[model samples]
Target chain A: MTREKIIQLVNQIFIEQFEIEPDQLTPEKRIFEDLALDSLDIVDLVTGLQQKFSIPLRENKDILEIRTLNDIYVLFEKLAAEHPDIVAKLNKEP
Target chain B: MKPRIAITGAGIISALGNSRQEVYQKLLEDECPTRERDDWADQMYGTYQPFAAAVDLPVETAKTISRHFRRSMGNAALYATLAARDAVAESGLSKEALQSGRVGCIISSTVGSPGEIYASAMAVLRNELQDLSSCQFFKIVSHSSAFNVANFFGICGVQLSPCSACASALQSIGLAYEQIKLGHQDAIVAGGSDETTPIVLESFRFLNALAKNPDWSPSELSRPFAEDRCGLVCGDGAGIFVVEEWSHAQARQATILAEICGYATNCNGSQISQSDGASIAQCMRQALKDANLNPEDIDYVSAHATSTPSGDREEASAIREIFGDTVPVSSLKGHLGHTLGASGGLESAIILEMAKNDTIIPTKNLTRIAEDCAGLDHVTSSRPKRLRTVLKNCIAFGGVNATIIYRLADF
Candidate 1:
C-alpha cells in the first residue's frame, strides 16, 4: 500500500479502537497522549495490522519505539511495499 | 523511625463476593467465580477464556458528583471504589478522620481497564467520537482506579497509582505501610483490582500462556508448580485493606488482622518479562532482613506464581534458593487467577486470613509438581496450620519484585 493508504488504515484502526475521530488522529498523534493507547493496545494494534495485511511484524527490540501515528504509518507502508499482494488486498477493501 | 503498622480494616470483591466475610467464606469452601466467554468474540483474535471475580457494581457507585464522570469507569476502578468504601466503613474511623485530610489512598492494577480501552477503540472504528462519553477517556488511564478510589472516599492526602504488573497491589500496600510508618499519613487505604478484558486474554493467548484444556474445568485450569500444568487462567477481582499506625489503631479500638512488619522491593532492570532468580531471592532476603527475621521464621509464603511456565519455574527456583526446600509455598492465583495489580493485595489479604484462621488453603490444582519445581513443600490441599509470620512476594512485568512480611496480631 502507498503511504497515504497505510496512513488511512492506521487512522481507521485508531478510530475503531479508541473512538477517536479521523481528523483528531494526526500523523504526530502519540499513542498514549492523543489516542490513550496503553501498552496492550499498542501490541494488539500491531498484531491486528500484521494479521490483516499478512505481514510479519515481529516483536523486535525497537518495536516499543513506535510512538506516533506517523511512525506506525511508515512501518506499515514499508511492510506493504514488500508485500504488494497484501497491500493490494488492503487497498481494495472499503 | 519505623512505627508498627496495623491492618485496621479490610474489604474485598471477588468472584467470591462483595464483602471480606463473603469472599473469606467462599475461599474457605474453595469456591471460585465462573469463567465466562467474552461478548466481543469475533473482534478478539484468539480463543478468550477470561474469568473474573467480577463485582456487581451499581451504576451509582461509579457515578461521580462531577459532570466529568460521564465516561464509563473501568471495572477495576468500580471494584476499587466498592472495596475502599467497605474498608473505610469497617475501620469505623469517623468522617473526621477523612475530613482531617491526613488520610491517603494507594490503588494498583495489573491491567487497568482493558474493556474500556477496547470499547474506546471500537468507538473510533465506528466513527462514533461524539457518541463516546467523557468517562471513557478517564477509564483508560493507568491511574484511573487509584484516582477514582481517592475521589470516592474524599481522601485528599498523597495519592499514588502503582502499575507493577502483577505486583502492583503488593507495592501499593507496601508503600502505604511505609507512608504510615514514616508518619506521612495516619491512615491509608491501599490494595488493587483487575477486570478481565479481551486484550489481556488475547495477549496471553498469543504468547501461548493460557491453558487450553477442554477437559480441564475452570477450577482445574491453573495448576501452578504442577508438572503437567499447561498455563494460567485469567481471573479478575480486587482486594483493599485499611492500614494505620499501631498506636492509632489501638487508640481507635480498630480490629487488627495482622501487623505489617517489613517490606522490600527491587527491580531486575533487565528483561521485561522473565524473572531474575537472583534479584527475586535478594528481595526476599532484604525483606527478611528488614523484618529482623530469619528464613525459618516465616511460617508461609504466598508466591507470585501465575501458572506460566517460565514464571512458575523462576519463582520456584527463587524460593528454593532463599527459603530452602521445606518452605510451604503456595499461590492464590490458581484459585483467583492472576488478578495482576490486585494479585499482591488479594494474596496478602488471603494470607492474613489464612494466618488468622490458622489454615493454609491448597495450591488448588497442583496435580503433578513440575520437574523444575521439585524439592518444594507446596501445599497441594487445604490444611489447618498455625502461621505466625507469612511472607508475601509479588513480581510485576517491569522487572519489579516486592516482598512484605506480615505477622499475626499478638493481643
Candidate 2:
C-alpha cells in the first residue's frame, strides 16, 4: 500500500480503537507518554493492525521498537515491501 | 449488640426505576413493568415465558464513561458504577472523603461479566481468538464489578467482592455493616449489580427454574407466593448503599435513611438449590437475636420469594415459623423480577423507602396465597403503617441464607 494509505489506516485504527482524535496524530507524539497507552494496549493495537494488514508482527522486539505513530507507519510500509502476499492482500478491494 | 451501621444513602437501577420515588410510586400503584422478550424465544428454543426486567440505562451514565475504558467495562460493571455514583452523590461526601483510607467498598455479582465470557468463548470455539481484544479476559473476570467501581472512584481501602449467587449483594452489605460497626472503617459503599444476559437465563432454564406460562401476561408471570407461581423471571439491575458508622454520619450531619442493626448469614450445607426451612428460620432468629429484639419488634419483612415455587414456599414457611401472621410481609421480586445478586440490595433499598414513607408495598401478583405459603399476613395491598423496623431475607444457590434487620431513624 502507499504511504498515504498506510497513514490513513493507522489514523483510523487509533481513532476508533483508542478514542484518539485525528488532530493528535503527530509523528513526534510518544505512544506511551502522549497517548497514555500501556504495554497491554500496544498488544491490542498490534493485533488489530495485524488483522487489518494481514501481516504477521510476531517478534516482540519489533513491537518494542515501535514508539510513535510514525514508527508504526514505517513498520507497516516495511512489512508490505518485504511480503508480496501482504501487498497483494492489501491491494484487494472489499 | 454492636453499634448500628447507618445507611446514609441508597441508589438503585432497575426496570421499575432508578430513584426511590420512582420505584416507590410504581409499587404503590400496583404496576408491573415486565414485558415480552420475543428475542429470547428464538435463543432459548423453549416455550418458557421468556420475560426479563431489563434496565433502561441512564444517558448520563453512558456519556460519563470514556470510550476507551467503556469497551473494557461490562454491563454489570457499568450498572455498579452508576449506582455507586448515585449513592455517593446522595451521601454528600466529598471525593476526598470517599477516597480516604477510612472508607471501604464491597460490591458483588453472580457472574461479573457474562457478555465478555460468552463472546470470548465463542471466539475461541470458532478459532477466531486472534480477533479478541487484550482486555477481553479483564472484563470477564469475576471481580470486574468491584474493581471497576473502585477504579472509577479511586477507592483504595478495604475493597471486597462477594460472589454468593443470590445472596451476593446482601452478603456484601452485611460485611460492610460489620466492618463499620466494629470500627474498622467509618463508611463503606456496599451493594451488588448484574446485567440481563441470555446465559443468565439459560442457567436457570437448565435448572428448570424459568417462568413459562403463555396464558399469563409478562407482568403477571412472576407471581411470588401465589398458588399459580411457576418459576423465576430473570431480571437485571443494581442497588448501592452508602453504609456509614452512626457517629460518623451524625458528625457529618448526613441524613440517616435507616440503621442496619442486625445481620446473620448461614448455610444449609445440604441441597445447593433447595433452601431448607429450618436453616432459613435459624437465620431469621439469629438476626433478631443480633438486633436484641423479639419477632414482634419487626413491623415489616422483605421476603426473598423469587416467584420460584419451592423457594417461595421455603421462605414463607420460615417467616411464618419465626414472626407468625402478624408481621406484614412482601417480596419486591414480584415487581423487579429475580435480579439474582442484586435482589437483596434492591429489595432492602425499597424496604428502607417503605419505612420512610410509612407505607407497606404488597406483592404485585399475589392474588391468591398458595397452600404452602398461607397463614402469614402476605401484604395484599399498599397500606399506611408506622413501621419501626424491617427484616430482609436472601437465599442463594449455594445453600447460603442471609438476614438483615433495618430500623427506622426517628430523628
Candidate 3:
C-alpha cells in the first residue's frame, strides 16, 4: 500500500526465495549484476513478485527497465498509482 | 567388435538403508523395511492397507549438495543426485573427469515430481497459477532427475531420461552400455530415482495393484511369488552407477565392480497393464545373444516381479522359458517393495555385491511358490553361491520389457 511496504514485500521475495541476507538489500544494489540472478531466476523473481503483490505483471512492459533493487520499489510505487484498486484493497487489509 | 563396459561404482538409497553397505547388510540379515505407518498411502488414497516402504531416514548425503544448485530439484532429483554423487565418489572420478564432455548422465523417474505435478494442476483449478514458485515447473519437468544430476556434477555429455515406469533404470543402464560400447562416450552416469507419494499409491490402487495382505508378517507383506502374495507395496529410492568403457577404466586403473555384458529392451505393444511373458522372453533371449552367452551361462535371473499375482506368474514363466527352471530366480521387491524406476539399478547394485561376496540373497518372504510359478528355482533363502553372471529383467506397465546381463569383473 505504501512505498515502504512495497519495498518490504519485494525485499521479502529476494531474502526468502534467493536466500539473500538483509544486508544485501540496499536499494542502490544492481539486481542482475550485484545480486547475480540469472534469466530463469529473474522469471522466478517476477513470479514471486506477482504472488506477493497479488498483481498481474506479465504484461507490464516497464519491468524490463528495472535494473536495481530501488527500481523494483519504484516500479511497485508506479503500479500503485496506476492500479489504485489493488493498493486500496491492500490498504484495507489490516 | 563392441567395446566392453565396466560398472566402476554404484550408489543406492532405499528402504533398506541410505548406503549400499547398509542395504546389503539388511538383505543378509533378512530384514524388511515396509511398515504400517499412519501416513502410508492408504491414509490419503484409502487403499486397503497402510503398508508401504519408504526410505527410513533423511538422505544425509544428498544434503551436502549446495542449496543454490538444488533449488530446481524435487525429492526424485535429490535421491538421484545423491546416488550419482556417491557413485562418482566411489569411482574416484575427479571433477575434471566428470566435466570432460565424454561422460553422460542417464537418470529417470516415472513422472518427475508426482506431487508437484498434481499440485500445480490443482493450482490451475483454484485459479491460483500465479502462486506457483519459480522452481515449481522445473520440479515437474519430465527430465528433472537427469538434468539435475548433470548440472550437479557439471557433466555436459549426452543427457537422457527414460520414462518407462519400472523399466526406466534398466533401460537407462542399457542405453549407457550402448553409448559407451559404441564409443559415443567414454563413460556415463546411469540410474533411476523416484519418491513415492499418495498419488503414486492411488494410481496403483486404481489398478487394483496395492498389497492388501495386512495380516501377513511385516517382513512377509510383499512376498513376490508366495502363494498368499497379494500385490506390490509402493516404495521410494534411487540407484546410480558410473559405467565406463572397459579400456578406459582399465587405463585409469579404476576398480571395475561388474561388467555390463549385454542389454536389450522391447515393447510387446499388445498388453498395456499385464506382463507379457512371451515378449519378456524375447528380450532376455536378445540380451543373451548380444552377450554371446547361452542360457546356461547365466547363474541367476533377477526378475521384475512386483508381488502381483499375474506379474509374478508371468515373469516366472518367462525366466523358465529363457534360462530354464534351474536358474536361481528371485525378486528383490520382497525386501524393499517395488521401487518402480529405481528397482533395476538398485537390484543391479545388490547383485554386484552378491557377486563380490560369493553369496546371493533370496526372495525375502517366499515361503511357498504359487503353483503356476513353480517351475523356476526360486531362491527362498540367502546362501553362499558361485556367483558370476546375472540376468536382470524388467517388465513395465506400458508393455516394455528390458533385460541386462551383468557378470563379475574378474575377466
User: Model 1: runs farther than 4 Å from truth?
Assistant: A1-94, B34-40, B46-72
Give the distance in Å from residue A75's predicted Cα in candidate 1 to where it truly belongs.
Answer: 49
Ranking by DockQ: 2, 3, 1
User: For model 3, how does the per-residue alpha-carbon lDDT over B1-411 read when each residue is reduced to its tens digit?
Assistant: 668999888999888877887788888898888887666543465434565787654545555777667788888888888888889988888799899999999998788988688778889999988778678878999889999999999999999998899998999999999998888899999998888877888889889898875467666778898898888988988999999998899999999989999899998988899998889889999999999999999998888899999998888888878767878888889998999988889888888888878778899788988997888888999878887898999889999999999988458
Candidate with best lDDT: 3
Give a tens-digit lDDT track for model 2, residues B1-411: 457689988988888888878899888987777787777676665555466887867766676877555666788888887788899889887788778888888999888788788889989899988889888876888777788878788887788988898998999999999898778899999998888777788898889888888788888889899999999888888899999988889998998989888999999989998988999999999999989889988899989999998999999999999888999999888888998888888888888788878999988889999999998999988879988988999999999999999888563
Question: In angstroms, how far off is B274's CA in candidate 1?
Answer: 1.2
Which regions of candidate 2 fall more than 4 Å away from where they truly are?
Answer: A58-60, B45-49, B56-60, B68-71
**Candidate 3 lDDT tens digits, A32-57:** 89988878788888898888778888
> DockQ of each candidate's interface versus the true one?
0.02, 0.75, 0.51
> Candidate 3: which stretches are off by over 4 Å?
A1-7, A77-94, B40-50, B56-63, B217-219
lDDT of 3: 0.86
User: Candidate 2: how close is chain B to the reference, as a TM-score?
Assistant: 0.96
Error of 3 at A94 (Å): 9.5
Relative to the unseen true structure, what is the C-alpha lDDT of residue B81 in candidate 2, on a scale of 0 to 100? 79
Q: Is candidate 1 or candidate 2 better by DockQ?
A: 2
Candidates in order, TM-scores: namely 0.77, 0.95, 0.91
Model 2 has a DockQ score of 0.75
**Which wins on lDDT, candidate 1 or candidate 2?**
2
Which 10-residue window of candidate 1 chain B scores lowest in summed lDDT? B63-72
